[model samples]
Target: MNAITHNTVPTYQRISVKPLAVHIGAEISGVDLSRPLASEEIAEIRAALLQWKVIFFRDQHLSHAQHVAFGKQFGDLTLGHPVFGYEPGHPEVYSVGRDRFKSRFDGARLVRPWTGWHTDVTAAINPPAASILRGVVIPPYGGDTQWTNLVAAYHGLSPALRAFVDTLQGEHKFTPPEGNKARQEFVSKVAATPLISHHPLVRVHPETGEKALYVSPSFLKNIVGLHPRESEQLLALLFEHVVRPEYTVRFKWEEGSLAFWDNRSTAHLAPVDIYDTEFERQLYRITLVGDVPVGPDGKPSVSIEGEPVAAHSVE
Candidate 1:
């Protein structure tokens, strides 16, 4: 949560929306994160997330505990991370920084050849429904994050292409980059990983019933029913389509700024230039537990490696 004066006229379900992008993001200016939110406020925020995909807030400098408290309003919080041990005492807070990234894939030191655009924790059969990130320290110039509207990307495809993708399933897994110095350590920590799960190429949003293109250059390997070359080529085209700038929104983080996004409908990328900079970029995140993704035909995601995520107490 970030601090901002709340004096806007009521609009969509109570809170007004000042959209950051035509398709994906909005600046929600009504609620204060530092205080306990009313049930109406939570409902409004949740509705905005489904409609806008991601929403931003300003000046809500909350502690790790406060961040988790706000996140609980929507759903149960996932562990700080499944594999990486982030924020020891505050198990629900994933603290990220340059020297140590507290994200799920933090310690891998596996640099993504691509922009690392991804929906968080897709390796799980059921990834998180949403994630809330608060900026503790932000750089003056770069380190901005960007998100793309997956639902828009799915709708952008030609009918024939959409039909083709709707029938497809793709393999997803996490493998450390070949040259990581701590590759073995990464393996040791995630002994249950290198997890391979299958999910539909196009996923149906559980809340709004919107369909979104769900594959990514980050973890998605190949389409199930195609040859390696065909899968690669088709996936390449889809990747390009999903990341088109027109379907995206960029947010510049400032200390006390917060970003709460619906992971079910978008892919996010941390700035590449933010790595190894002398300037500090510290942020804390809390993830909401998610359901197994369902495809257009109504089949649910089936795991090849692990069980569905068990729900935990929101408190």
Candidate 2:
């Protein structure tokens, strides 16, 4: 992997980037996120995000406002969630895992294999282009999050399959599981504010112009205009290919660790290992507003149910 040289970003002279995997993740050092960033520093960090898909930082414990401020450096921040709403005072901060007031039954309580994998809020017409997550409380031995590089996964497909998927579109919706005893409130909220989006199976990156497989099993319902059986078979095949070990990176979180990822070109899986155990995990996340996905054919995604997620207001 080519290092971000002084020529690339002048401020990167002090910043060091180390790749954690060949395709996806990198750890960045020599920059403190707790404070404000200069224009050149922001540019360097953005460049690293475009190249690595996901960048990690260790030992920078940020406050809720600090995290939101950091995310606003790149672009306008989206509300914590389209359906679930935001943390009390911080409209841009989304609290994950178990916390003092809320238990596991409140958020992402279900633990099925398919339910763990998703791109953040893809059910919206315009999904977030990027997401920043900071680790607050972490468990000891379990709870590792994994991210897969969709650009690499798309290229890994056979040429014929790539051509085929380039012409297809899929429907995504946040539907609650049937007969699940755990999250009844989650089900009620989803039913009240239904969201569904129709997006291309392959989306072209707005900034880099690269094509990525836009498959999020958790939200993607089916391919548009195809027979149910055919759609199911094809989606299952793509899902299996996207998470191959070679194109993915697993991250272990600590108290002050943070992960900033390009949501347009990746899918991530949250761990289920800490669910029933005695351990507790908590993380805070903020996302940047993204445009509607455009396919290689230059068609933009359409909203089927619900309004587009609005930008977060500090007021």
Candidate 3:
């Protein structure tokens, strides 16, 4: 496929949310998230998501059913929290709740402390393609989700670094980094599922055919054939590169707002600043199915682009 020369402008209708970008994301208005969407409208929404990596719908009054139905337009749904139970009659919906409250049943924490940059289910052999998250109760301040454009990050790499990373394989597992006793305990109590898988460092977008950096600091354990210290340093550098502010966008959440993001080409972090407070933040999330990852070189491996090149190298 030919490279996309200019970004595609989104065609909008009836909605109030303004378009945040031309190529990848939009904000829709004048619609209630609680209500059902028409077939044609759903099609338009899907198209927007495909071109833009994210789409935001604001001021929605979504019921569990409404949220699930909206997500179904994109693809098959996956169950949230392999261990924690779901809301009644809505098996696909995962409820995120605050940690301060004691519940009769098990529920995942929705507090700010849990916010970290990650893609949904990178540990899975086949991770989700997209995710739809609806804010239920939001904090007064200090909880926002930030997303990075991996495609742009990858394109900025030098050809030699790109080629080197294209051939390397990295391991992704559920183990929390050594140290941090509190987090380790939390992981054990959650009975968090551990997954081991391999993915290419550089991945080709199935639809757009653009290459993206696929590494995440949270899930990736090490690159194959590297020493522990070396792996840690290398992965840390790559993570910093992918998360540079210029390639990222931050979205502040509002009660009744919904954000849909493509897990394939983006990595996100939820900021956790509101700690030890009465304020509670909750969100409902749904993950969609994805295929096994493949690299730009047509290999079943991952790659990382190193430091920027000298100015002379460009000309």
Candidate 4:
């Protein structure tokens, strides 16, 4: 790992941010999430999130309600998912862990090697601006999640390739994986509420104006104007490039750990090592409302099948 340079000064007065990697992740300390945050603290946290793509907090044991409260400090929360239902009573919380149905359908719950790499919900016309996830029941080892900085990945591309990608758009929708065929309920829900949107391949950050390669392997189906073969080859190259080891940071979760990421500028890979193991893992996530993604040309994403994701109204 590259060491933090002396020129990389801390940005927040209220919290201490320790960068985990040269480009992407940071470990933040000095404030409690369970309690209300002061205005200065909230602003600094947002600044840290924008700078570091994803920020981690260790040993914050937050209740479901407290988790929701901390997310509200940043922005209005969205439903846990566009299709999958939320955790009971906590509409904003999406529980992530082992899927019982997948195990029941087969002796071992197997998944496609590429299925876990994705942004939160790209199928929505307006994907979440940010997501806050808290670790619940964690395993003894394994199950580490990894995130890549899309902005850095975009800049890493050759100047000619970046220029070409700037003019392209890609289609995103939720499609059940081949492994999910055995789970009828999973297939049925996806069929009933299909969300499809056409988004710029290179999205301009609404807040920072930086361009990011908006690639979500799990949700993005194809580049809109390219031939099937051409799209596949191009996407394959981009996918492999965006996840190059230099652009990523891996996090090993502890029970009270939490991660907050800017959904617009990052892509994450969920834990693939924990499946079929005897260990148990569970986590809760809530997303903040995001605006329609605008491309370098200033054109916004267009929804083909579903309504834009609406903000959740807390009671």
The RMSD of every model to the true structure, in order and in angstroms, is: 4.7, 4.2, 9.9, 4.9
Which should have the higher TM-score, number 2 or number 4? 4
Report the C-alpha lDDT of model 4 over 37-115, residue by residue, as the tens digit: 9977887888888889999999999999999999987888888887887999889899886653463243333354345
lDDT score, candidate 4, position 94? 90
Error of 4 at 226 (Å): 0.9
- For residue 166, give model 2's deviation from the true position in Å: 0.4
Positional deviation of residue 27's Cα in model 2 after best superposition, in angstroms: 0.4
**Tens digits of per-residue lDDT for model 3 on 89-113?**
6877888766522432233433322
- Candidate 1 lDDT at 220 equals 87
Point out the higher-scoring one by lDDT: 2 or 4: 4
Cα miss at 117, model 1 (Å)?
0.5
Please report, as a residue range, the 10-residue window in candidate 3 with the lowest summed lDDT: 306-315
lDDT of each: 0.79, 0.85, 0.68, 0.86
Distance from true position, residue 147, model 3, in Å? 1.0
TM per candidate: 0.89, 0.91, 0.79, 0.92
lDDT for model 4, please: 0.86
* Model 1 alpha-carbon drift over 4 Å, by segment: 1-10, 101-114, 177-182, 312-315
Model 2 lDDT tens row, 1-315 = 111121245435657889999999999998999898887777788888888999999998999989988888788888898778789988888888653324214333444344557898999998988899999999987889999999999999999999999999999997643223436666777777788999999999887889999999888889999999999899989988898899999999999999999999999998777857889899989888888899999999999998887787656
Clashes of 3: 13
Ranking by lDDT: 4, 2, 1, 3
Model 4 worst lDDT window (10 residues): 1-10
**Which regions of candidate 3 fall more than 4 Å away from where they truly are?**
1-17, 21-25, 30-32, 83-85, 100-115, 182-193, 301-315
